[model samples]
Target: MCSRIEDVITEKARTALLQVLGPLPWLEKAQGEVRPTDQIQLIRPYKGGHELALARWGFVSAGMGTAALKKYAMFNARGETLSESRAFGPAFRTQRCVVPLSAFYEWPTVDGKKRKTRMSRPDGLPLLVAGLWNRCEGSEGTVESCTLVTRPPTSDLLSVHDRMPALLLSKDLETWLHGTPEEAQTAALTSWRTGVLQMQAV
Candidate 1:
């Protein structure tokens, strides 16, 4: 299963990203909590290259209660099903965003024993995971939440799990965030094949 990754963004990483993804007032107010309407961050680093872009939080909705507990919390949507799934189709058509992380966590089960692994770039850069967002009205009030998109793992990620977050590159962030339906689909289907990500036992 996928979980929060460790390795803080720190002041340097945050400041660097802000310089690249300018005019992002929302990021100044961002904290670590996964709240509705909170700004999600995105950073894209190329293979053996510098970071491409940094984005502030976007919006998304999480399934509540039974839906959340049982149905994966809408944290990830399959890239292959973006054009088909009812819950994700609309978001795929519009409202796409990027999620930044220095690392992410996944649990591996070997011989009935579970082990946690931390995945991150070998060069210590950020990884950009594709995301979708939507606003929903709840009894409490209006909330915005987001879900990460997933696809078959790249060769580098297969040892950890069958699926990995759909990682986006700098060249495609604009299209993924503001492209037509077909463009979004093409961008989503592209494989994440940059930076050597390391999976260490945590």
Candidate 2:
């Protein structure tokens, strides 16, 4: 499972997202590696187009105490069991989102030790990854959070990791965001092809 991701919401990425999903006038620009519990930008389905919202990287359910967050990890949700998972099933059905990235990092063993690897598209466009979001109301305030969806790794990246983030192509973004439950399930299960990314030791 991936616990870290590289920079997202760059200027280039924002442009790419706007080009495909149409104008998101309120989308803010940001850049940096993201980790669990970090606040990040999420593209959500809204008003027949897309809208930009801010959400913490990890999924937080209603009434889930702070201490519980430390006990469980909800940053990445497995695609295969999404429908069966209490933490992910509801969001998977109605709260699908896109997590855009300039690149993502993975640690793979090289020689005698594990080395950091950066994986990105050859054309330098943003990679739109599938995700599920939720809103939890607590005493402090309302917290919105999200979790990335992952599937079995492609052959090209199997040596790097056993699972990879589920990516959404431009054509399928709508289906993922607003399709019926069944159609959305199909979109979630579709993994991007291999060779679309180039990995480098970093």
Candidate 3:
């Protein structure tokens, strides 16, 4: 499950990124320590165009109180059940999005102890992970949130964890954002090649 991430790009880097990934919405700095419920940068297809928005990174159940949310973790949705989960099904079909991050954190059991691990693109480029988003109304307000879609692990990633976030590489991003849900699901199942995704103990 992708629960924490790093977005260590500088402001200048973010500006350059915006040009390539923009028509972004107004948002504050998101260049480090991203966690569940934090405002995260996401891009979604809308009205024949792409717009970047500051989206919360966890799915909030409708009408759940704030206190309940504090103890809930809906940051990762399993891709195998994308069409089956009540909370994520509709969003997966219609509100698909991509999450941008430099790297994501994981905890893997090694030598009988769990250790912090970091997974990133070997090329140092930012990654766009597949996701589903929703806007739910509650007593507090209308909360817009998202969840990463995870797939069964690639052989390379299996050493770190049994699952990895469904990533949309440059070659597949456009189709994933614009294709039908069935197409997107098929695309997401194509796992990353060995040596493309780097993992290290942190």
Q: Pick the candidate with the highest lDDT.
A: 2
Instruction: Give per-residue CA lDDT, model 2, range 1-202, as digits (tens).
Output: 8788865556766678778887775455455677888887778988877888889899998779989888889999998888898889889888999988777889999897999998889787988889999998987889999999998888899899998988878888888888886787678677477779999888
Tens digit per residue, CA lDDT, model 3, 76-189: 988878888887888887888887778888999999999998888776677678888888887767788888888888787777878888877667776667778778887777
TM-score of 2: 0.93
Candidate 1 local lDDT, 1-202, one digit each (tens): 3445432465655665565454333344333334322345543323432233332232334445434534545566888888888778887786676676667777878678878777877766666677776667656676666677877887777767888877776677767776787887678778468446877887
Clashing pairs in 1: 39-57, 40-57, 41-100, 42-100, 60-144, 60-145, 60-146, 61-145
Task: Write the candidate numbers in order of decreasing TM-score.
Answer: 2, 3, 1
Pick the winner on lDDT between candidates 1 and 3.
3
Cα lDDT computed for each candidate against the true fold: 0.62, 0.84, 0.77
Which residue runs does candidate 2 get wrong by more than 4 Å? 26-31
Question: What's the residue-level lDDT of 79 in candidate 2?
Answer: 86
Stretch of 10 with least lDDT, candidate 2: 23-32
RMSD of each: 6.3, 1.6, 2.6
